[model samples]
Target: MIGCRHRLRMDAAHGRELRDVVEDSGVRQRREAAAAHRASVRDTLIAAAPDAWVVIDPELRAGARAEATVRACEAGAQWIWGALLPQEPDTGRRGGSEILMRDTDRGGYIPIIVVNHKVTDPRRPGPADFHPLTSELSRWNPQPDKSRKLRQQPRDQQRLAHLYRMLQRHGLASPSLLGGVIGLQADRILVHDIAGVLDDYDRRYADRIAVVRGQSPTTPAKVPECRQCPWWTRGAEGASCEQWLTERHHVSLVAPGSRAEVLRGHGVTTIEELAAWTGEAPQDWQHGPFDEAVVTARAWLAGAPLVRRFETVRVQRADVEVDVDLESYQEHGAYLWGTLLDGRYRPFLTWDPLPTTDEGRSFGEFWTWLMSVRAAARAAGKTFAAYCYSRTAEDKWLYESAERFAGMPGVPTVEQVREFVDGPEWVDMFQAVTEQFICPNGKGLKKVAPVAGFSWRDPEAGGEASMSWYRLAVGYDGPPDLGQRTRLLEYNEDDVRATLALREWMSPRQPTAHSAVEQVPSLADFALDPRATPARTPAPVTASGGGTLST
Candidate 1:
C-alpha cells in the first residue's frame, strides 16, 4: 500500500485515478492492513528497548499527544518518533520538523529531523517548487530582538541565521538532519553542513524575505504565477476590483525586473496606460533608451506582432538538422523523445517498464540512431545539429538516462553523452532567442514559438495536458487509452516543429534587422469584411516529410 504523499504524486502525474481509490472501501482496507503491519513491527522494536525510542502517532488526540510527549520525556528515549509540532499561534510564523530527537545533555536540547520524499543534496539544489523549507525560512524570524540587525546583514547571512534560529526554536542546538527515503534506503544530512547549497539559493534569489513579511512592497515579477492572477484579466466582465478601479487596464509585457519596476513607478500600471504614455522613456534599453516596453505593450493590446532586432547571432547551417523535444513523467522517467527531421516527424517512445522494452531501452535506441545520423553527416563532409528549445529539461533527462543505462548494451558512454551535450552540435533555441530579442511575452517557447508562425495540431496541447495524456497512455491510472499515445506523439511532434520554425525564423538566412512589427489592426478588421479576399489554405505536410511547404 502506497503512502498518501506517494499516492498524491502518482495521481498528479497520471490524472486523478488515485482520488477514486482513496474513497473506496477496498483501498481503505488495504491501507488499514499496511498500517497494522507497520504498527506491529514498531511495537516489537519499542518493546525490546523502550529507552531507545518513543513513538507518537499524529492521528492521536490532543490529550493523547500530551500524554505521549510526557511519557517519551520520562522514558529517557534518545529519539522521539512524531511529526514536527506547530509553533505557538502568537509566534506569527509557520514551520515544523518531522522528527524530534533528544540531544546528549550539552544544553538539554532536542534536535529536529525533517523527513521528505525528495533527496536534498547540498551540492545540487532542486527546482524552486520542490524547496518548501526555503519558503518557510524566508518567513521565520530567528531573533526577534535583533530583527533590525538581522535585516541589515547580507541576505545570505540573514537566511542562514533564520534557518539556524528556526531549528533552535524547535530545541535543536546541533545541526538538524534532513532525512528521506532515497531510492530503497534511508538517506540523511546535516542542514548546516550542506556546503554552498544555501549560497547558490541566495545568489539565485533577490532577498524577497522582507516582501514576504509585508515590510516591503514588491513589483510584479514575470513568473508563471502572474498569468493566473485575478488581476491579469483584461476587457472581461467583473475583471476590475476596488484595487485596480478600472476595466481598461492591461498587464505589462515587460520581463520582470528593473524595467517593470520603472514602468510601475511612473504610473504606467496597465497596457492601456503604457500605450498612451508619452513621458520620457526609461534608460533601461540595452542599446538605447528606446521605449521597447511601450511598443511591445501596444502591440499586445492591438493583437499585433511584437518583434524587434536588438541583437543578432550567426547560426551555422547544418546539412542534416533535427529539431528535438522530450516529454517525460517525472515519477516514471522519460517516455517520449520526438524529433522533426527536416520536415518529417519521428518519435522514439517507451511505453513499457519491462527491461526488454523500457524507457532506458528506448533512450538507448534513440541515442544510437542520433549518433549514427551524425556520423553519416560527418562522412558526407557536412555538419549535423540537434535543436532543442530549452536545455534545462532535455539536458537533465539526457544525463539522467545515460546514468540509468550505464554499462547496459546499446547505451552510449556517459562521457560520450556529456560531449554531445556540451558540443556546438546541440543548439539551445531558447538561449538563442534570449540573446536576440526582449519579448514582453517572456522567453517561454510556448509564448515565442507562435510569434514565429508555428501552431500546434491540438489546441489543448501543452506541458500539463501532455502529462495527463502520458498517464493515460501508460495505463497508470486505469485501462490504457489507445488513442492517447497518438495524441502524445502529435504534441511532441508539434513541439519539435515549433522549435524548427523558430530556428528558421532566427537563422542568418533571413534578412538582417527585419522587424515583423505591423500597424495594429482596427477592431473592424476582426469583423467580416466582404471586400477582403478569402485567405488561402496551405497543404498539410505528412509525417514522413513529403508535402507542400506551409511557411
Candidate 2:
C-alpha cells in the first residue's frame, strides 16, 4: 500500500490537496485502486488496535509527549514506528533512537521501524538494509530467545550486531536477494559497530557543554570548537583574546597544546617577558631561540631582512623577453593567453568551444607566433625567454594543449612542450622569488607583486574572480556579460605586468636595499626586434603608477 509521506508542518489544506490527487488517479484505475485502498484501510485498522502500535513524528515539539506515551505502554505496544526528523539544533544530534530509548528500565521487545522519505535515490539503502529480518524469521520460524535479549544492548551495538548476524546468515551476501525475500545493495550500504565511540563522544560533549556554560572552571584539553563557539568573541575586538595573548605574549599558538602550559610554567608569558627570560631553553618547547628571534624581528621591524634560505633573488638578463600570463576556465579550458613582448601587450582569445577551432585553435596560433618570435631572436644571436609569475597553470595548460593537439598541424609535440618548460626559455618568477626570500605576507602573485611596486587596475580581479567572469562570458547560467570578458583581460594584463615588475626589481642592476622610488627600465630599451611596436606611453604619474621610465 502506498503511504502519503509529508512533514509535520504540512497543514490540513495541503493534505486535502494530496488526497484529491490520489483519489482522482485511483478512480481512473477502479479495480486495482479498490484493492490498494482496502490494503491501506486494513493496515490503518490494525495500527489503531489498542496498544498494538505507537507512531511518533519526533521533528515536532509535540512528538516528545508521543514518545513518552509509547514508553508508558511497555510490552503492550508491539511496534514502535517513527518518522525520521531533522537533527537537533546546533548539536547536530539525531533524536529518533534516543527517543525510543527513553524508557530503558521497562524494556521488552518492540520491533522499531523508521521511515525516511528524504532518501530519493533508488540506489541508496533504507532502514531494512541496516536492520534486516532474522534468519529464523526468513525460515518462517519465531525469533530466538537470545536474539530478543540482544535488543536490550545499547542502540548502536544492537543495530551493529544485528547487521553482523544478518551478514553471517547470508554467507558474504550479494546485492540481489540475500535469503528467499530480502535483498542487500552492497554499493549503497554502510554499517559499523560504534557503541564505544558514541559513548566517548557523549561524555566529551557533556564535558564541553559544562565548560561552555561556565559550570566547570577547567577548559577542555581540545579547542577545535573555538572556530564555531559563540564565546570566541570574549577577548578582543579585532582579534580573538586567545590569538592576542598567543601572539603578543609568546603563548603556545595552539590552544590546549603543551607549549602554552610550558611557557606558563616558566613564567615566560609575554614576548617582552620571554625575551628577558634568557634561562636554559625548556626541553619541551618546540621552538628554539633562533625561531623566537625571527618572530621578534618580524614583530618589531616594518621591513625585516628576507629569510635567505627561502630567497633566490638574482637577475637573469635576456636579450628578448616576453612576460606571459594565461587566463583559463578550469571546465572550459584556457581561453585567453596574454603576452607582453617589449612592453606591447597582445592577447590571443577564444570565445567559442567549437572543436579543433576554439581554445585549441587559439593555443596553436599563439604557439606559432611565439615560435616565430623565438626563431627570429635566435637568428639575431639573442636569447628569448617567456616569463610567467607561476609555472603551475600556464605550464600545465601549455603541455596539455601540446599533448591534446599533438597530431594537429603547427601544434608543438609533447616532447617540444616538455623541453620549453624544462629549458631556460620559460622562466617562472614564483620559483625565482621562492629561491631568493621567505615572505611572511604570502607567496601569491598578488602578495609579492606589491613589493615590486605592481598593482591591478581593478581591485576585485583575481584568479577565482576571473573564473566567475568566464562563467558569465560563456553564458553558463544566463545571457553572457561581455563586459566581464574585458575586465578579465585587464586583470590578465595586470598579472603579466606584475611579473615584469618583479623581474626588474630582482635585477642585479637595481639597488640592494628597498627603495621608495626605483627607476624601472622600459622593455623597449631591450627589444630584439626593431620592427615590433612599443607600448603606448602614458602621462607620467608617481612611481606607483608604473609609467615608462626615463632611465
Candidate 3:
C-alpha cells in the first residue's frame, strides 16, 4: 500500500522503468548507438520490401503491442510485417521484444529471415535470453487477415479483452512492453508471467496467434530470443550463473584484501578468473590437498548466498534485492519440489486421492493460499521476503476434473477464504519482485535459502525430513472427508510457516550493507578497482539435471 502510488506512477511509463536511467549514461549511449545500427540495418531491409507489400507499425502502449502485432499477422495479406526500431538498445528493449513476437501460442514460431549484423561466438551466437524476430518479417509478406474471418477477429482482440479487464480492475495498463505477450493465457499456469506462455484455455481462444505452451517440438538447436539478451554471452562463462557466488564471496566469505591476494595467486587478478574456479570448486577443492589460502577460498565461496550479493561498486543508490523460489508437485502428486538458490528440495504439501470424494487438488487451490499470504505481506510492507514452492506436476485425476474446477477460487479472502481469487497482477507482482530487485548469480530462493543459514542438511529445521513428516498430521487412509482435507491444509500451511520462519531467521543477519574490501577477503580485488577488470570469457559449463537428495 505504501509504495503503491510510486509503483503506479512508475508503471505509467510502461516500457521505460527507472532502471532505464543509468548513472554513467554510457550504457544508454551504447544502446543508442546499437539502435542507430539496427535502424540502419532495418532501413536497408525495409527498402528491399516489394512495391505491393503492406506495412503496419504495431506500436501501441507498451504491453499492448503483442496483441496489435498479432492482429496485423492475422490479416493474412501476402506481405504482413512490423518493425520496432527504437532509438536505444535498452530503450524500449521491452517494446522491441514484444513487437518481435510471433504466434507462439500454437507451437508456431516466427522465423528470422534476415540478420544484417555479425554475432560473436557461434558456439553461443545468440544472447543469453531468446530474441524472436519472426514477427518482424512484416515487410516480406502480404498484410495478414486477408480473409473475411480476419476482419471478424484479430489477434489484438484477445489483448483487448485482457486490456479492458485490467483497466476495469486496476485502472493500469499491462507493464509488458507488448501487452501480455501471452494475454488471457495467464490464468492457466501456476507461475503466470510474461516469461512463460499463457495457460491452455486462453491459447485456444487466440485464433490468429499460435500458442507455444509446451516444450517446443522444433528445438531451433540454437537458443532463441535469449541470444540477444544482455545476459547472453555478455558475461564470463558461468558468470551469470555464478553471479550469486561472486557476490556472496564478496559480501560474506573472503575479506576483500585476502580475496584479491588469492585471485592474484591464481594469476586471476582480473575478472578473467572464469577458468580459475567453478562455483562448486571451493567445496570440491577443499576435499583435495590445497594450501590454506586456497582452502580458505573454497570455504568462503561454498557458504555464499544463492543470489547475487555484491552491490554495483561504482553506483551509489538505493539497493534493491529480491529472494525468490518456486515449488511444484513431485511424486504421487501429493509432494512438491522447490527450486531456489540453485538447489532443488521437496516441500511437504500433499493430498491422497480417495474413491469416495477427494481425489486430486489443483495447483490453484494451493496458489490461492500463497497469493493471500503475499497480499498480506504486501499490505504489511515486508521486504526481502522468500517463498518456497514445489515445482511438480499434478495427478491424472486433477487433469480429468479440470473443467468444473478450472476457475474455481481457492484462497479465501476476508470475505470468503475460497471466494476471491487474486488476479494476474498478483502473479505479476511475484514476477516483478525480482526484476525490481536484483537476483544473485541468477539465483533465487533455492540457492539463497541454503546459504542464508537455512540447512536442509539437518532435520530439526533445515535438515533431511520425511515426506510423511509433511503429510497431514493424521494418517492418509480416509474417506477424503473435510477432516482429512483440513489436515492436508495444515500440511500446506507448514510450508508457508517454514518459509516465513526462514525469512525471519535470516532477516537480522543479512548483510546490512555491501562489505567493503577491507571487510571481506573474497571481494578485496573487486573492491579495489571494479573498473580494472576486462571483459571476462567463461569456460563452457554443462548444466546437470536435478541431483537426487531427500529433505
Model 3 CA deviation exceeding 4 Å by range: 1-327, 330-350, 353-404, 407-444, 457-498, 505-525, 530-551
Better candidate by lDDT, 1 or 2: 1
Query: Model 2, 143: alpha-carbon shift in Å?
Result: 40
lDDT of 1 by residue, 147-175 (tens): 11111113333334333345455454344
Give a tens-digit lDDT track for model 3, residues 403-511.
2244445512232322322221212222322322222233333333333233342233211123323322324433335543443344334444434333433333344
Off by over 4 Å in 1: 1-55, 61-76, 92-95, 105-190, 193-223, 227-305, 310-314, 353-357, 508-551
Top lDDT model = 1
Candidate numbers, best TM-score first, in rank order:
1, 2, 3
Higher-TM-score candidate among 2 and 3? 2
Model 2 scores worst on lDDT over the 10 consecutive residues at 1-10
| Residue-level lDDT tens digits of model 2 in 307-337 | 3332234757688999888887542367888
| lDDT (C-alpha, whole model) for all candidates | 0.53, 0.50, 0.30
TM-score of model number 3: 0.26
| Cand. 3 Cα-lDDT | 0.30
Q: What TM-score goes with each of the models? A: 0.62, 0.49, 0.26
